[model samples]
Target: MELKQVIEILNGNVLTPSANLGRQVKGGVGADLMSDVLSSTQPEAVLLTGLCNPQVVRTAVMADITAIVLVRGKHPPAETLQLAESEGVPIISTRYGMFEACGRLFQAGLPCLERPVNGE
Candidate 1:
């Protein structure tokens, strides 16, 4: 699925104006824990998390994740937004909870792409 489709499907708003809506989203990973995300995330997958923090963006960078979807209408602090912008990571906010957001993307043909911590 394309990043733009994710925004439309979830009724999301782009928090980062610099975000490229044309970026390809190969899969999805929903998690509140940054550690969990670092452990299981796949490159180019969209991250769905309710946690509104700068660390989320940092995690996305480290994991090579495509974009971020802030579920449950959560908004991060100013630093989070600034860091995301500096890092060139797109941040999107949606009123839908994590589960529903994931469902919408899954229904749209975006599979859940997660890796085992053990690299299995």
Candidate 2:
């Protein structure tokens, strides 16, 4: 799934790194706990979360996640946007909840790639 498709699926709007909306997403992961994301998120996965904090971007960086979809219409703080901007993780906002966002991506054929322990 392309980042543009995620925006279309969740009716999201790109708030930062607008140019990244066309990036390709190879998988998806839904998690609110930053620790869980760090443990489980895969490269190329579009992270779906309601956690509106800079740590979210930090985790996205560690996991190499390409895009972040803020679910339930939640938006991250400016600091988070700055972090994402610096790290090149595009941020999008959507009214859909976490489960709904994940389902939408899955229904759209975004495969759930297995998360290896090392995520190599």
Candidate 3:
């Protein structure tokens, strides 16, 4: 789905003014643990989390994530927003909780990453 669609679906507010809303996101991953996100998320996925920290932006950069949705109406710190801007990661804020946000995106046709059948 497109980032613009995500913003509309989640009723999100764009915190990064420079972020492009036209970017396409292939999938969605909801996690507060940066390690879990790093291990599981695919490239160009949108990360949904309530963890509003600079590390989230760093993790998004490392994972090649396209966008970030901060659930539960949480907003990142200025430093975190600055880091996200520097990394070209768009940060979005939503009033929905993590579960609700994920559900909304899923209903909107964004799938979660699938684990390999071999458990690799």
lDDT per model vs. reference: 0.93, 0.85, 0.92
> Candidate 2 versus the native: TM-score?
0.90
RMSD to the true structure for each prediction, in A, is 1.3, 2.6, 1.4
Give candidate 1 regions above 4 Å deviation. Answer: 116-120
Off by over 4 Å in 2: 114-120
Give per-residue lDDT, candidate 3, residue 10: 95
Report the lDDT tens digits of candidate 3 across residue range 2-44: 8999999999999999999999999999989898888778789
lDDT of 1 by residue, 93-114 (tens): 9999988999999998999888
- Candidate 3 C-alpha error for residue 89, in Å: 0.3
Model 1: what TM-score?
0.95
TM per prediction: 0.95, 0.90, 0.95
Indicate the residue-level lDDT of 63 in model 2: 89
Candidate that scores best on lDDT: 1
